[model samples]
Target: MSEALLEGGTRCLRNVLGRFATGVVAVAAADPADGTRAGLVANSFCSVSLEPALVSFCVAHTSGSWPLMRGAGLLAISILGAQQRAAADRLAASGTDKFHGLPWISSPGGAPVLEGSLAWLECTVEAEHPAGDHTIVVARVRALDAIADGEPLLFYRGTFGGFSR
Candidate 1:
């Protein structure tokens, strides 16, 4: 209940959760009107349902890019491959152009889909719920495809790597 206990608990929770390996994804979108792009890398992406074709990802409340991307109407989730670690790092960083030199193409729905990704999904925002430090976004998939055959870029123990067969 004390401040010190709360701080320690937070740190511990993060450390504990880091043990679960997760695939990394880039959630991105382009403004249909002006061509501006916004994106962020996330390892908190997962399938939420199959009946209605839904997916979800978590975005930090502190992320400056989320607001811009959120209003873009449609979004693309690119499943990163091992070769795209640089792309992940660039998207994860703040205070700079995340797509300056990033090679990407627009999805059918006008969202930015990073090149060299293993797969991609274009979706529209279905719902958003406020979590502790992040917003849980549920998306309705409009289009999706497996782009290439490769191992996925993964995050584990606070670091990025690829899984081996």
Candidate 2:
């Protein structure tokens, strides 16, 4: 395959995949000792197993927040609601404090659970595997709860929106 062909193929793959809409989430954690926090927005969250209460999300290898959150031992996954688009944008941005103006409460395990999220899951990293440009994180759900009732924030075709009945 020629270089131009490979580049075009990669873009095509991304465009094709973007056709599938997905819900957005904030994957975050706080250092128990210092209360430092790290987080990022991800639309790739998924359930892996029910028997072990496992969930998974992908983080890009270049993500600055992942390294900080990874060492926290505990992580929180907050399901973003349709009204939380600003929060999502902040978390997805680079080189800034993701939680600076975001309201959140710490989970029992010291993970930051964003307030106003539709639901939240407290988890611990069970395993990680490198996949191309991203790392797949499998987590064991220690605890979880639905916090609010609302439409989920979604991403489709490179844009974000809410579902309609």
Candidate 3:
């Protein structure tokens, strides 16, 4: 096939997948050396297993935050609630102070544990694989917290919204 056809095919696949609704979450880790937390908002979070409590998320190859988080032994996956739009944007932005005004605590592994999220999974990255434009990170959940309340922030058709019953 021609290069144009391959490119078009890739975009077509993404467009089709975009029809599926997904919840947004911020994945973060604190640097052991500097104690700085690096994070990014992603809708690619998903549960991979139950027996061993495995979860996975995708990060773009160019994502700077992912690298820092990968180096850490543990990470916090905060499932964003509808009211945490600012937290999402803050984590997604460039430069420092990603956790500026966000309320969070330290997890068992010293990762930043964000409050007000629907849930949080403290995990250690177990495996990684290159998938198209992103890297799939599979992690084993060492600990988890479920905050009972609030509507989840949803991502669909390139926009952020909430879900109904």
Better of 2 and 3 by TM-score: 2
Q: Per-model C-alpha lDDT, please?
A: 0.93, 0.92, 0.88
Clashes of each: 0, 0, 0
Question: What count of clashes does model 2 give?
Answer: 0
Model 1 TM-score, 2 decimals: 0.94
In angstroms, the error of model 1 at 69 is: 0.8
Give the Å error, residue 56, model 3: 0.6
- Per-residue lDDT value at 2 in model 2: 59
Runs with alpha carbons beyond 4 Å of true place in candidate 2:
1-7
TM-score of 3: 0.89
The global Cα lDDT (0 to 1) of model 1 is 0.93
Candidate 1 residues lying further than 4 Å off, grouped into runs, are: 1-7
Indicate the residue-level lDDT of 50 in model 3: 99
